[model samples]
Every structure is written in C-alpha cells, then in structure tokens.
Target: MVQGRIEKLRFIAEEMQIAFHLATNLTDPFFARTIARHILVRAENLIAHARGLRRPLRDAGFDTNAFHTAKEAYATEFEEYFKVARHKIGAHVQDFDFGKRIELWNDIEIVKLSYFVDGAREIYEGLAALTVPGYVPYAVPAELSDPKIVEILHQIQRSLDARTWVEMGTDSLAMARGNTSAVLNTTPVHARAGQLALIRRWIALQLELRGKLAAYPAIARLFKERIVTDIVSFCDCLVTRPVAADALQAMDGLNKLVQAENQSSAAIDDFVAASHFETDLAATRRVRDKIGAHLEIDEAETLPMLLADLNAFDLDKALAFYDRVAAAFNKQCFAVLFLRMYAADGARLYGVTMGHSAVKPFAGVAEPPPAAPPALPLINDEQEYAKNLRRWLDGDENQKGTARDFFWKAFMGSDSIEDIKETEHFGSGTRYHSHQFRKAHQFLLDALSDGLSDFDFKGVLDLVMSCRGGAPYPLSEVLVRCAPHAPVFRQYLICHVLGEIGSEPHESVSDFFDAQAHSPTWAVRLEAVMARYKSFIKNEGVFRTNHKGQTKVEHDALVASMTQAMSPDERLICLLGFASVHTGPLAGVFTTPFNSNYTALQAELEMLILPLLNDDDANSKVAMLKQLIQTHDYVGVSVHIAINLNSGENHPLYAALVDACCRGTIIAASNNQASRHLAISYVMKKDHRFAFEIAGPLADRNPDWIDAQILVAQILGEIVGAEADARKRVSSIRSAYKLSPMQEAALAAVETEVQNRVTRQEE
Candidate 1:
C-alpha cells in the first residue's frame, strides 16, 4: 500500500511544474517535449530498484539508512537533471523552483513543512525497519517512464518547477565519472589513426597505371591506328556542309555554350595547353571521330547535350551510389590473393572522363593511352568579364534564350548569394528567380508596418538584410522566431529582439533596454543601452515624464512585457531589473538621467537586498522603504515588501504581504499604470493593516508583500518589546529550532505580562 502511494505521489509532482510555466507565459513547447521524454527514462530506474527489493521490509534485516542515502542522492539527481531540463524548457531553475518560489509568494513555513515530511519519512522507515513491521519508501525519482505512472509522480514533476531547471538543464552525471575505479585497458595504435598510409599508397599506385595511358592518343596517331581513322569519320559526320537539321540544332547549342563562356574559353584553352596537354585541333578532330567507333560511348544524343549532363554532376547522389558500388567491389575482390578494389571516384571527376573498365588484358585490342586532365577554367581579366556582366544586368526575361544563357546571366548578377556560393556557378537557371527575398520583403513591408508574416525565418532574415537604406525597424514581428538569441543582422536584429521581448517601444530606444536595466545582463545585455549612455544622462530628469505620454494602459502593458522576460531567469535578472528600476543618477557617475531618489542610501539597496531582509537600520534603509506605502490612500496603516525577496520589510510588494496575512487575498483594483493602487488588509485580532503593491521591471524591486511580512512580524515583536527580565525568563515554549537564550528570555517576559494582565482583568 505504501509503495503504491509513493508511486502515486511522484506523478502529481511532475505534472504540477509543467502547469506552472503557463502562469509566467514563458513556456517553450520544444523544451517541454524534450524534458517530458527524459523524465520517463529516469523514472524507470526507480521502478527497477523497487522491483529488485521484494517481500517488504519485515522479511529482511535491512539497513534503511543506506537506502535513505541512495534516495537522497536520487533527489539530488532530480534537482541536477532539472538544471538541464529547465534550460531545455527555455527558462532557468531560479525562475521556477517551487522551494524558492514558495519562499517568494507563499511562505518559508510551507517549505519548512516539506522538509519535515521528507525527514519524517526517512526516520519512520529506519525506525520501522529496526523495531516493527516493514516497508521502505523509494527514492525521489527524477524521471518517470510509464505513461500511467506519469500521472502519479508529483515530487518528480515538481522537481522540475525550479525555473532554471527548464533553461540550463542539469546533466545526469554518472554516479561517478566513467569507471575510474575499474582496471585500465588500452587498444591498438592503428585504431587511433583513422587512416592507413599503406592504403593510400596502394590506391595511388593503381592510379599510376591509368596515368601511364596519357601517351595513348599520340601513339595512335603516329601509328595511323584505326582510332585515328574512326575519329576522322566521326568529325566528317558532325561537320557535313549542308548543316543537317540535327547538325543545325547542335551548332545552335554549341554557340550558346561558347557565348555563355564569355571569352573565358580563350583563357581556358590557353591554360589547358600550358598545364596539362598539347592541343592539335586538326588531329583532335580526327581522334574524336574515331573515338566514338573505337569505344562503346553513348552518342544517342547530341554531343553538347551529353557533355552538359556530364558537367552537371550531383556529388551527393554519386556518393550514395558509390557506397553500394564500393561494397560490391569488396565482395568481388575478396577471393583474390591481391585484392585491389577499384574506386572510380577521382577518375570519374577530374581524369580524362575515359571510363571503360574491362578486367581482361587487351590482346590485339590493346588501347592507346589517355589524354591529360582538362585545364581548370579561370577568369583572368576583370574587364573581359564586363561583357557577361552587361548581359546579366541588361537582359530582358524574353531575351534570355537557352537554358545555359539564362543560368549564366542570373548567377553572375547576384551579389550576396553569389558570394556564399563562390564565383563559380553551373548555370543561371539552377537558382530560383521568383524566390528573391529583396523584392518579396519590400512588397510585404509596404503592405504592413509590422512587416511580413507567414514567412519562415530565412525569408524574414533575407528581407531585413536587403533593406535599401539605413533605418531601424521594429523587430517584434520576428521575435517569436528568433527568440532567446537575437538574430544577427548588423546588430539591428538585436534591437528587434530586445524590443520584442520588451514589448514596448520607448520614447527613445534607450528606455527599452533601461527597462530591463536591472537584468544580470542589463547594461551589458544590450549594447544599445550603453550606446545611449550619454544621451540618457542628459535627458534623465524627464524620463518618467518622457515615457509619461504613453497612456496608462500602454505603460502597464510594457511593464507586463518586462515581467514575462524576467520570469524565465527570475533569480538571474529579477535582482538586476529591480535594482535598475530607478537606477538613473547612478550615485557619483555622470548624472545625465538624474534620479530624484538617487542617494548613496538607495544605491546601497543592492548590498541590502543580497543580505538578510531586516538586517540594516543603516542610512539607506529609509530610501528602501520610501515608496512601499503612500499614506494618502490610507492603508489605515501601511506595510511594505521588496519585489526582490519575500523577506524585506521595505519590499515594494507591501500590498501582497498585507494580503497574505489577511483573508489571504490581494486585489490590484486599478489597471491604470500611474494611479494604480493595490488594496490589502491584514488583521490580527481586532486590528488590521493595509498597503499597496508597486510593480515594474524595477531592479531588486521591493514588492509590498516582502515588506508586509517583515512589517507584520515587527508589529508583533514591538507589541511584546517592553517585557522585562528579557534574558532570564523563558524556560518554556520550546520545541525545535533552538531559540537563543535572549529570545527565550524575551518571550518568557512577554508571556508573563500577558498572563498577569488577563488575570487582573478577570478580577
């Protein structure tokens, strides 16, 4: 029964955390899908362990502490796994962890109870194992495997609630680094090297035999071989004077290919003669005619068509085919003593394109040697390329005739795409013309101020980069796509990302970043903020009023947007954002954005918020408490809390703090940004207190709740402050968390007075 209950408890926890992300509006579905899958895997480990231990605790002399330690480790693993899971989920653990969160909005008392429940379970198991009937609870699993079990693992699910767990995931470190405790083993040196020199040498030698064939054409001509005669016949057939219909078609295609070459052929022919071969166009014509009849070459189509197909080789598809061919070669070569596996890769690409592989040695049919490789093409003269460039920039859609001509024109014209693909292009027609992003974006942007939608990321990106003139455009439209990391486009994309996340365009762009000004990455996160550093200082005084032109609804909308951005890494940025809320005057720095509240004391709030909430009655304490409550509205009496923490008495969230103590209700009655008032009521006996919650993307913001809690505690403490004999009084009212001697003494004194007063009243 206990085992089943524990299993059920695990399910509830896992699902609860998933639900919490929606509350902050930072739920990233991609991350959620990934984390949920991993949770299932880890849960299986716990189920496996439970299966191994059967017959319950009563049947064995079990050491429960050992199991408890393992379980504790398991819980730690859950927290660790959540570190990565949270990152994967697109938030940070600090933003979602329930333990930390409960401390913020709820109370530490609740987490304290959680600690108690965990401790009680451990103790009960050990004691029960030692003294009475038996059953041991399993580890707090970080993963859940079974679909049905996912519905039961509450702790495992809640384990992921830590906000950072969704953003920066914790790796499931092996209980220890891989096998350090085990004996060492090693492998062969050849395994480490990836390649064998002997294999390279063997392949090269086989190519050498083929390379020796380079003298074949000259030898055939010298001998007046059949190859020479066949070549003449083929040339004659192709050059027939009347220009047969097929011949006419061939001439036209040849004209286009040469035209497309745009005088590059002179350079190509010159390089070929100098680098790899000796050209004899008259002998070449004779050899070429005979080549068709001497060897079985495919000539069912015109020569240009065949050559074009050969040049447009698709390497990826070739490799795929080659894989199968390679396997076949090994199988064929295996039985031979000398296994020289044939690979046509290099020869098919750069060699003389002579591919006739016959296993049998030539008897009387011995072939002449092969010619050298084709001369690589190069554009030697910049001015010469101008002809093609003119054709490309001026050609009408109709004047572009022939596939080769169209392809050449389009390619040489594009600037950016041409750069990425390098100067060389197969043909102008290969690229998609209608998909031009520049024109598409101009059309879309003209139609809507927000820019295009329904386009993918690449499309939007291309349009932004191709803008005609220098100007800034709002990036909110693309924010949903290039989230978290700002898109890279001369840093303009960064501004868009910031604006999108910020959700409001400030009177000046500086205000947008200054808004998150408290983020850990604040001031540094967006360079634009620092860019306007001087300007901000100059106009600092008018900031509140500058942005004041925004309607209250708009201002509130902006604040909500800031909160959503901060929610993901609440711990990472909340302090930074809160601290920067009024972070103008910046103490002694050049005071451009002069903050009226800028005093050394307010600056010290950074130091105060990090430490205990109620610690300092120092100079800055008053500045911290200043905006917590405004008496004009009548809290009847006011309380305060910092948005920074749930502890500080001067917290900006005083309203929530007051509300938490009362009917536990917090109502932000007004939606107006400037005149907004949070009404709160905290009553103890016949007395009640009230306060308001001030909110914004303010750094280390003092939420009213944090101050409210501390305020109520102070009011409780002060009412009992006058008790006498403070130190030596209380020897009672003690249970846990050993109250110091002074607290005991003080409490004893207060208790005595209260009792005495009640007695007198009774008389």
Candidate 2:
C-alpha cells in the first residue's frame, strides 16, 4: 500500500516539475500565468500526498524521520509561494484590495519555485530508490531542441561547475601566494567529481526551462547575469582578501612577500588584470544582490525599470562581455587543472604554455563525445556472472529458473573460499531486485557448505557478517549445530556472529552468547552485549516486529547477565535501544497495557545510564539524552528530573539533562518559540530550581531572545511576588536594554501592573 502511494507521489511530483518549467520559462504571460497556476495547484496537491505518504513509508520499515523534516521545511517555503502566487493572485482570485496590485513576480521567485519542485522530486526519488529497480532519473519531460536553448543550457551548466571551483581556487591561490605563488594549487579528484554532479543537475534544470515556450530576452538577460555573477564569485574567492591599506606598509610588505611571489609565473595578478576582474565582479554582484528575487522591488517599480537604462542589458554588449568573462574563466580553469596535473606527476612543473594548452578545451564550448558501439561482449568471469544475474532477474519467470539453477550449480562447483565468495545468487524477486542484489540465506549456506571441507571458515564468517536482513532460519541454530564439529571456526564465529545475533530462541543459543559475554577479548564481550540488547528489543514491543521467541524469564535472564557483567558503555546501548523503540515525533501512538510493565524497567535503565557522562566521550550520551527529550515521554522525563531537583537528590548526571534541555529548547524555538517559552514557564511553575536551570542558560546566550526573557521575567514575578525592589530591577532592566516595539509593549504591560501594586502599597 505504501509502495503504491510512493509511486503515485512520484508521478505527481514529476508532472509538477514539468508544470513549474512551463510556468517559469514560457515568454507568453497568459500561458505562463496559466502554467504557474497549474504548478501552484499541483504543489498543494503534492504536499498533501507527501504528508499522506509519510506514515506508510515509516510503517513499511523505511526511516522517514529525516525525510519528513526535509519535507516540512520545503512545504513551509512552498506555502508562502502558494499564498502569493496561487491564493492571492494566480488562480483563485481575479481581483485584490487597493493596497496591493498583482504584478508578475520576478524571475528570482520563479527560480525558488523551481528549487521547491526539485526538493519534492528529490524526496520522491529517494523513497522510490528504496523499493524500485535501477536508477530512476528525475527527467523533465520536454522537447528542447532549439540551438539557442541548447547554448543557454550549456552556459548555465558551465557556470554552475565554475562556481564550485571558485571557493577551492580562491583558497589555493591564497596558499600559493603564501608559498611565494610558485606552488601548484591542486584539489582532490573528489572535488571534480562533485562539480560534475552539480553540472548534471544544472543541465537538467536548464533543459526543463527550454520547454515549448518563447524565450523572454529580459528574463534571459537576468539569468545570464546571475550565472556570470556566480562565475565572478569564483574568481572573487581567489582575489577577495584582507589587505593593509597604508601605502608604506603595503609597499614594505610587497617588497618582502611580493618580490618572492613575482619570481614565479603562478601569481594570480600575472594571470588576470586586477582592475578588470574587480570591475566585472562588482557589477555582477550588484545586479545579483539588488535586482534578484532575494531583494524586494519598490511598490511602484517593476523589473523593466532597470531596462530604462539603455546600456543595462544591451544584447550586443552582453555578447562581448560573455567572451571576455569566458576567456578569464578558461584561464582560471587551466591554471587550477595544471596544478593538479603537476602534482600528480610528482610536482613536475610544466611551463606556463603547457597549462594554457591543456586547459583551453575546458574554457571553450564542450562538444559531445562520440557514441560508442552498443552490446560489447562480456570480457571476464565477473562480468559474465553479473550480466547473467541481471538478465535472469529482469527476464521472464520461466527464464528465472534457468538463472537460479545456474547460480546453485556454480555454488556447489566452487572449491576455494575465493571461488565461493565469487558465487552470485538472486534469492527471490519478492525481496530484492536488480537495483540492489542481496543473495538469499540458503544460497549463502550452500556456498559456505561447498568450502567447509577446505576449512573456508573465513568465507563462512564473511557471509554471516553480511546478514542485514535476518536469515530464513535461526542463524543461532546454524552456529550451534556447526560449532562443536568445527572447532577451528568456533573462535571466528564467536567474535563475528555474536553482533549479528538479533534473537535467541533456544537456551543453548542464549547460553552460547551468555558464556561469550565473559570472553577475555573485550571486543567479543561488547558484541555479545549489543546482540543481547537487540534480541530483547526485537522480541519485545519495540519495533513490534521480528520476534525471537523468548519468554519473560529468558528475557530477564539476558538482562541480568548484561547488568552483572557488561560495562557502563554496554549498558548505555541497552538503555538507548529500549528508549528508541518508544521514541518518535508524537507520543501514545503505540500505547498498550503492556507499557505499564516496562515503565519501571525503563526508569531503572535511565538511572543507570545517566550518571556515566564523560567530558571525553559525551557524544553518545548527548545524543541519547536528546532522543529521550524528543520522545513522547519527555514530560515524564522532565518531571522526573524536577522531582529529583526538588528533593535535593541531585545526581551528577543532572548537568546532562540541562544540556539536553538547552539543545531541545533551541530546536523547539526554531519551530515554535512560544512552545519553548511556555515549556520554561511550566518548569518554573513546577520548581523554581528546574526553571532557573533552563532560564539561566537561555539568558546567557542571546539577549535578543526576548520571548524567553519575557517568560523568564513572568516566571520570576510569580516566584518572587510583586516586591518594590523587584519592580525597580525590572524597570531598570527594561530601560537599559534595547527592545523592539512588541517587546516594549509586553514589558510595558508587565511594568504597569507592577506600578499599580506599588501605588496600592503606597496608598
């Protein structure tokens, strides 16, 4: 059912991207407005579908936590667009109030709309990848064969790729100058790979923009400048730096460092004219900053206001500008590429001409590479095996039997551990597919069986360790049955398999791990502890799936063994595993009478885990504490801490709670500042001790966090009563600080009440 929803969402999301493309790119205002309205409606629909898809995705055993967060953020930004573009003007309303006039929004706003569409597409694609076959490209279905459109698309991609180089090139140029500008400024090959990815995405968007629509010259001009600005920013990253302004110091410094730098041909100033670079970059920056969608235009003005200046967007002049800018960009790409080649060749400095020759093609218009002949014959055993596997998986059900038979025979025929490892099998189509090839447990067992006589224990162990999805039968039973007969492989299995053991159905299996818990090897013992905790969680309510048939008595025995022998760190894992089963964005989703039985156990586990915080390794503790605070039981946890503070039974781990609260408060504030403020108020009402602990940390940070301060003040007034001295301090604090009108209004009301109390006292 979830897969069906995800598939439906992907289809809708793909159509939305197409609508957005038509909306933004069409030169005809009437058609563009029509398409834009369609996009807005589609966006609203897509959001509703995405929200619906979330729960199903989570229940389908996919983690939707991070995806949901990203979706919410995208939805929020899209909502504002929906309000303005659709609700107010585009589709729903033809008229508006006198105060507001509907002017077509700038191209910059259109770009942002495109980003939202891409964001939605990304989420849908990611979900699809989890359950679909092969690469599902987010291809924008459009016809864009015009030369003008193709040229513009390439230009956009080249500029986007160049933007990545800017930051890296700037850093390299600075370091080069430090080394007297002689050193090659090589970046990692990974950086190039990353840049290529950006280029592909940019290509996708630009192609989408070239849908069957007339190009608007004004919008195109603006887009060109945006691209140029990005390219300039890359150049600027190299040139922009802190420098001494005083002439004497500048000259003196130049003599000391500049002279040495001038001896080398790699100096940035030698490659480009500083004055020209500065002029072009500054011009582009001004247009991007002042004219783009990020900044608001005056109410009376529109985008065409800039075109009133005759030379502002002259097509002829832009062409000339492009040539000069493109050349400079090419030179920069060459210089950076040369540095990389130089480094790779053991710092063999090719002369300056060699750098120019090599980098020239990157700067020019890139031509498509020649297409290779299709259907190359399989060249190796690995290639042949992979080909046959994919063909079988993709072929008919009847043909799949041939593939399965071939795979099994290959496994049985295998003699060495290496050959057994090389054996491939596709267990069933119901589970995994060509996109992700995970062999069945039976196939792995067969492969292991083939090599067991040759003492291929390592191969068996490797296969066991690779088990992410549990085996069809108990892995614990298989190990138990094999261990006594294969003593040579016992130690290897003992070390590796213990971590993979999710549940123990039998006493012998439980005893096997229980005895290993006391192993001399700390690593082996730690693995056993983790395996036991996993077993406990899976067998029990947490996850509520994948049961390991262990009775309460057996489960308690495992916990008892862990508590008696495992270290604090190991216990921390057990505590976290228990908490995670219950943790989520909302509480009470899985509430049953069974929860009451585990409440005491949960409390006891929290107590044991909390005190073990260390300055050296508090990352895990901090993370666990944050997760605990986010859980539905946060109110319970907070109340527990407040009770502890009230009784003056402050545990050493109380500081960790404070840290968790502070972090949670920051996240909560971003989502809802009122909720955070009210939380502070609630704690203050419970115990001033708890309230002050939270309020003190919040106060120490931003004074501008007036909501927090206002709540803190209100809480203080409740705690202290309306004393004259307290009123004076509040008045003094209000006057001393700068406050926004809203803050002042809130403070004024609080002060006026205090003044009233003071007057009554005087009367």
Candidate 3:
C-alpha cells in the first residue's frame, strides 16, 4: 500500500512538471488527482484495519479505544478533498476529473513549482534527444543502447505516464485540442512528404551522432541538449514580424515536410510524449481535439510555426517580452508558490517496480535505492559566491566604488541618482575603523534600502562589529542590524554570534525588554527565544549523562586510591558506576562468584546503601530504591564486583542512583516488601574457577538476615513454597558452607542436643 502511494505521487509530480513547463504556469497550484486518491485509499485501509480490531476489543471490554480510533480514521479518509474545496485550483483540483495545470503562470511567485524544474535540465535534455536504438544501422535490443541514452529515454517516458493525462508539445498538436504548448496535425498529404524529408534528415544525423558516439561514447552527453537553439530562434522570429495567415500556411507546409522525414524512435522522443508515440499517437490526437473544443482557438492555431529569421529576438525584444509578462502578473489574485513534490523519478526508473507492464512488472522484486551520481566537480562554490557578494556589497570598481558606494548604488539602483547624493563622507574614503556612529548608521540605511542576499547582510554586520570592539554599539542597534526580522533566529550559528555580542531575551535579555516586541515576522522572533530554551533543555539532560560517564571513568582510580588510605564505606560509592559497566566473566584468579571475593564486595555494598536506605530522598526514589532492595535480596552487596568496577561517564544519575544503593544508606524493613526492594545488581565475573560469595549483611536491621530466613521458614510451615525446590538447587553451595569455621563455632553447643533428639526419635 505504501509503495502504491509512492508510485502514484511520483506520477502526479511527472504530470505537474510537464504541465508547468508547457503552460509556463507559475500562478496556478497543480495538485495531482491520482495522489489524493492514493492518500484516500490508504486512509480507508487504516480504517478497515481499525474496524476489524474494534469488534474483538469490544468483546474484551477494550472496545471504546478501538471504536474511537476507527471512527476518527474513517472521517479522515475523505476530508482532504472536502476540506480544501474553496480556492480556484484547490476546488477544481479536488474534483475527480480535473487535471494538473491552469493556463497562466511564470517564475515570479513560483515557490515549490520552481523546485520541479531541474537545474540540470540542459544536461538531461541533451542526453535524451539522441537516444536512438540503432544510430548507424546495426541494431541490438533497444534497451541495450548507451547507458546515458537509456537514462534519457526513462526521463521522457515517465513524464506523460500519469493517469487522466493531457497533451504537450507535438502530441498536443496531434490531438488538435488540449491544454497544450504547440501541436502538429499531419494531413495525409503532409504525412507522406514530411516522412520522406524527416527520413533523409534523420539518416544523416544518425550517421553523424553514431560516428561521434563511436569515437567517444562518454562525450555522447553533449549531442542531446534540449532545444535551446530552437526556442531562441523561434522567439527571435516572433519578434521580427507579426504573423499572417500566409506565414501560418508556410509554417504548416514546413511541419508537413518534417512529418514525411522521421520514422526513427529517437527523433519522435525529441518531441513531446515521444515515448508513447508508438502505441498512443492517434489517441493523443483525440484528446487534443477535446481540449480545443473548449479553448475558442481554432485547432490549426495550436500548431507551432517555423520561421526563417532566427536573430530577431535580440536584447530589446527579450526585455519587452519580459516586461509585458511581468505586467500581466497580479500579485493580489495570483502568486507563484513553489511546489516541492518529490517525484523520485530516478528511483522509480531504476528501482524494482510494480504494475506498469500489466502483470509482469508486479512480479516479486523489492525496490532498490537509486544510484548516486558520480562525483561532479565540487567546484569553487563558496569562493565564487563570496566574490559575487563582495561585488554586490562594495560596488564593482568598473561599475561603482567601495562598500559605502555600493550601499547608495543599491538603494538608488541608478548611477544618476547616486551621483547627485555622492559625498566623500559616504564613498571610498568611509572606513568602519574610525568607529564613526553616523557612518555606521548611514551604512545600515543603505543596506535596508538596497536588497541583499542574507549572506551579504550578515557579512556586513560582522565586519562592522569587528571594527568597533568596545565602541558604544548598543544591543538594540546590533540586533536591528543583524537579526532585524530573525530569518536565522533558530540557527545556533546565529545564536552563537548574537551571544558573543549579547542580545535580547538571554543573559542580557532584560536590556531589550521591549525591542523584541516590534519584530516584523512573528515566526522568526519566536524561534529565537525557542532556540535559547532548547539549549538549556538539551544541556540539563546532558548533564546527568556526563555525571555518570565521569563517575565510571574515575571508578578504578578511586578504588585504588582509597584501598589503603580510606575506609571501605568511603571507597564503595565511587565504584558503583564502574561496577555497572560490565556484568559478565573475567580471567581466572578468583573462581566462581560464590568465592570469598564476592562475599567481601557483597558485605561492602550492603554498608554503602544501608545508611541512606530509609532517608526521605532515597525513599522518594522508590523505583531505584526498590531495585536496590531487590539486588540486596538476590545477590547481596558484591564487594568482589565493586573493586573491579571501572567508572566511565554514560549516565551520572544512573551511577549516582547505584551509589545511593551501595553507600548512601540501608533500608530497615518492618515488612517483607520493604526489604525486597533494594537496587542491588550483581553478576558472576571470575573465570572457570569456583567464583561466588558467602553472604551476610554488615549492618543491623529491623528484620535481620537471620530473622528474614526464619520468616521464610514460618511461611513454609503454613504453606508449601518455592523453598521446597530452592533447597535442592542450593544444596551444593549450602553443603560447602554448612561446616565452615564460623558455622561450626556457632553450632558447637547444639551438636550434642541435636544428636540426643535424633537418637530418641529413632528408638
């Protein structure tokens, strides 16, 4: 389902691009009908899944959650179209039948629309035009053509593949009526003649291109550039003279002559919708006829006319044309809003895909990520950019003068006005180094009047600040100069710059209590404060982590340092973070964890958490305290593990919590739950040797270890428990410690009494 949406959105983008290019429509917002349907279809699928689950959940008493989820999803399933049904394109686009573009638009207000235009259009167009299957007569599988040519063919093929498609280029003309750029209607007589002419021209070009390709397939990239030459020529021809019916007739004759010439697939693709020419030419003609019926223009008027004069569209003509187009643009009614619809055509063209070639394309193959292009020249991007900005900031010597001169030049936009206002005080002689407040003020005024890229403005402010280190540059003036409207408000780099000098709503925030209120753009100012808030929020979280990391890193050193110099309790807390780092086995010296080494660490760990176990703060950390209690219950204080713990900083609070567990204090439990909640964590670390511990607590408790053991025994008397099974598992360790020196000494007096009782019972 996800894959389907991706493909559908891709198709929508392709359709939108072709429409935008054809109509030159920068004002209209193109929305894909296919994409909306896909989104709806996906919403429905979610609703269905939710509904299916709601029934079972209802039976189990969780139905309310399921029902609400399903109900909401169902409503959202179709609200997109219904919700956006107000604007001209928005309303019409929501309609099931409406297509991608409206007739008028250009570059001025176009936002996302411009993104769809490839910066590399020339490169791709160049590659596509000459993608002929058999250039010099020898033919292999059409797909086996040159790699670059194959890529080019894919680019053109995918453009017109959208559902509910409209025509563009020659296809539009062929159809005779459609939202089209230009069209060609091949009358039977024109067809024969044009085919012959096209064939002769096609053969000649093919032989030349093949020779070029054979000589250097790598450079074969140059031959296929889009028709820049053709467009320029046509524009010039149009400017040279007004069109007449006779001229139109002559143009028609010329098109007819070409129609007779080209039967080659490559030449066909060079025109619009060429990839589909083989199967859909006649169908295209039908669609064009439908569009023409509505446009009031005659079908014949849709065709592009050929011209003899190619140099007519010179500098003056081009300027005049732009002026007229610019005047037609109504800012209030329509603005070009750039649209960024990710077509991901390259990924689709190259990746494993589904559903294009009937059932075959849908075969079992997963999509692969698109290949990244080889390294193009990284080129002198920033350097050249900076130089251009320098020229803009400080007027070019040939055009104007220095930075001060450039400011006036930018504001006036004409040399005559600049000349009238020119003063030595505001020209090449002006220097920021003098710390002249008036000059700085003038510079700021000049900057505001003459528009500059964000980079240039930022550069100017930085340079000024550098010149006057201790000068009375107020915070208000500084911010007004650099962050005026706050476009880079959230950028930390900008924040850092501001911080170095000082600004509002920060450590020095009180100084500009009201300066921020007059912000031009709310979005930009809000982000500045948000950036500061985000910084503190981020660091506080980091502080706790650093604490743990530092604790871990210092653990080993602490343990060693305290070994002979400090008491056991003082050294124990320092080892907590390190002990937590590793939980598994180590080399041979100490055997199993049950060895005396563990008993020592276990004894020490108990002493650590014992003192604070009942403290209010420790109790407040119930979860951590509870785990500490459990660790003590199951593994006891592991002094063996404690000495080995190496501290590193990952989580300071985590290690700190462990420190509270091992050293802060001990918990005195009046009930079983209290004693069962310790945060002790222990594990076997020694190698194959008998590694383990002999457990005992160092401190006194409300219910001591012996007392707790008795309680377990009393509970056993009342009911059978895991004790019956636990005894068997502990038998080996219990036996080993059963007659130890400490045990024997304590049981010495009971030995005779136990023997007498057993003897009497046997009798």
Best by lDDT: 2
lDDT of each: 0.29, 0.43, 0.29
Backbone N/Cα/C clashes per model: 91, 1, 94
Model 2 vs. true fold: TM: 0.29
| lDDT by residue (tens digit), candidate 2, 1-763 | 4544554455556656655554444433322433455455446656766787677667768777777887788789776656555543332222232123223222214555667678878777766546633325666544332356545545544543332111122222122111111322223322222222222222223334433223644334333433433333333333332346553212111112223433332334432432244444555555544332122123233323533432264333333333333333333334454323222211212111111111112112323532543332232345445544544546654344344444433433333332111122223422221111123323444444443534345544533444323431244444654554444335435434544444334455567667667777544554556555555544443434223332343445655757665555444444433343344221243323236535756666566645543413546544654465445344334434433443232543343343333323112222223245435535534565556555545543333344655655654554445355445535534633455788768767767766676677689
Regions of candidate 3 where Cα sits further than 4 Å from its true position: 1-34, 38-372, 376-558, 561-570, 583-603, 612-626, 629-763
What digit string (tens of lDDT, one per residue) describes model 1 on residues 1-763?
A: 3344233223323322222221112122212222232232223223333323333432555545555564555455444433333222112111123223222212111222233234324433443444433234444433222343333233333533332100111111111111111111111111101011112222232233223333433211212222222222222211222247664223221112223434222322222222111222243333333221121122243324433433343322322222222232222223222222221111111112222222111112324443554343222333423343333334543222221232222222332211111121223433322212222223233333333333333333333333211222232222322333433332333343333233222333444445334545422343333323323333332443466432222222333454454433232233222223232223234232333333432344334443434435574544444443221121211233333345444443443334322321111222222112232233322232232222111101211112222222322332333223222122212311144566545565546655665566579
Best model number under TM-score: 2
Q: Which pairs of residues clash in candidate 2, taking residues 3 or more apart in a chain or in different chains?
A: 166-234
Q: What are the models' TM-scores?
A: 0.18, 0.29, 0.16
lDDT of 3 by residue, 649-725 (tens): 24233343333333212222233332322322211221101111111121112111223222222222222233342
Clashes of 1: 91
True lDDT of residue 224, candidate 2: 41
lDDT of 3: 0.29
Kindly indicate the candidate among 1 and 3 with the higher TM-score. Answer: 1
User: Lowest summed lDDT over 10 consecutive residues: which window, candidate 1?
Assistant: 165-174
